[model samples]
Target: MEHTQPEQGGLRESKRRDTLQRVAQAGLELFLARGYEATTVDDISAAAGISRRTFFHYFKSKDEVLLAWQTGLVESLRQAVLQEENRQAPLDALCGALLKLAADYDSDATFAIAQLLRSNDQLRAANQVKFLQLEQAAFEALCHLWPQRRRRGRLRMVAMIGLGAFRVGIDEWTEEGGTQPFSQRIGHAFTMLRAELQVASAAAPSQ
Candidate 1:
């Protein structure tokens, strides 16, 4: 029975993920078809073949359903950073982990959700909250990954730069309607940031 417990636990978690995915898919379909303002929780629940209570179990509100991808991305980035093994510079490691995430991103779903957030005031607010949560998580992970620089504020600065690049990459990708791959756009953004950093370093006076 003890051995079966882990298996059962995994199965339960898998079911939960499935339910959440279904709810999100249903919500997206309805939102796209009828517009975000016209779609209701009941509409999503019915479309997903689940009861309203079950819909609430998976998502707190309609806006949350749209932001669910952000939660997944944060967790993925956390795991990637934790498992990273390359002995590169701290900032390089952080940027590499972020680029890995961009490479594996779902551009279509992201573009669709971004469009919804832009059209709805409430969803945009919710997205801002999610962004803050992601920023905090990334900053803490960077500090842990490079403890020596944490106190001097260098890690914090690196985290900010990394996130800035990510945000700009996503914004540009969304602006293009996701026509180009997100990973390519993110790589370009990082390259530009690195070049600017190099120029700044070269211009700074030596002590």
Candidate 2:
């Protein structure tokens, strides 16, 4: 018999990824060309050279196509955060992961896709939900980084602070190329939040 087992498995996985890619590309192109609201699932399926049933196998709906990349991003970010060396602080680890993800979107393909997402209301709503999911994933990863969540003095506060800083950094990076890099902005945001928190703590009246 031919040695078809491993090769067959690899081919199957590659074909699945290719199907998803084609569906995503078709959806994005239609969204950009005819506008997001006007583009239907049928339109994308036809463009991708697949039937509607096959399209559903790759993505649930057209909204999913715009938010597709996010499926793998949370896991990628988690890996990046966990693999940092001893020199990296918690904030540094978080920023490094977030910045790397931002850099992934700096390409021409991603730029056009971003513009489409910015202009489309349906895509915007879906994108917002996907972002919330990512934030929760980040929180879970941070909790894993420092076990004993209940014993930690400010676990939730610290998690929220890191995520907020990363959000601001992303907005700044997208709006302008800026003098500084995205990673630097992420660090600066965290530093500013820490300073403001310290000031507020000091200003509180003691009982």
Candidate 3:
């Protein structure tokens, strides 16, 4: 006799993933087509062919659906930093992870999502909140990459600088309409950061 238990579990998990993707796609389509404020949760549910209750099972709110990709990226970055095999310097690891993330976002669908956020004040504010959350999560994750004593005061500074570079790189990429690859833009941003640091160090008085 075939064991139905494992099959059932796999099928359930697959259905959940499908539901999540459908909700996200529906939300993005509505937000892009009708404007973020004009579109409601009901619209997304209807477009996704699911009940409002079913939509709520996947997302608490419309904004959550819109920002879901960023949420997942933040968690992935945290996990990447925490992994044992990522032995690069803290800033290097952060930059590498963020560059890969930017590359993932380099698509027409993602550009449309960005445009939606840029055009909507409420969505932009909500996205800022998510960015702050991502920053805090990243700092904590980076701290875990070193011993407690080693992270007492240093990891915070490194995290701040790393995040600054990431934001700058993303802004530059978006502003340029993604004409250049995001990885190259991030590399240039980091290179400029390194030069500024070097200049500052050279000008400082030797202790």
> Candidate 3, 105: how far from true, in Å?
2.8
The residue pairs found clashing in candidate 3 are none
Question: Which candidate number would show the highest lDDT if scored against the true structure?
Answer: 1
Instruction: Please provide, for model 2 over 1-207, each residue's C-alpha lDDT reduced to its tens digit, 9 standing for 90 to 100.
Output: 367998999999999998899888788878878977788999999999999999888887887898775668878777766665535456556666676766664455554565566676776787777667667666666667766768344545555677787767656655664445545666667678778978999999999
lDDT of 1 by residue, 47-139 (tens): 999999999888889988767656677777777676665367656877788888888875676677777887867877877776666666677
Off by over 4 Å in 2: 1-9, 85-89, 108-111, 118-121, 151-153, 171-192, 205-207
- Model 1 CA lDDT for position 85: 59
**Which ranges in model 1 have alpha carbons more than 4 Å from their true place?**
1-17, 149-152
- Per-model lDDT: 0.79, 0.71, 0.78
Q: How many residue pairs collide in each prediction?
A: 0, 0, 0
Better of 1 and 3 by TM-score: 1
Model 3 / residue 186 / CA error / Å: 2.2
- TM-scores for every predicted model: 0.83, 0.75, 0.80
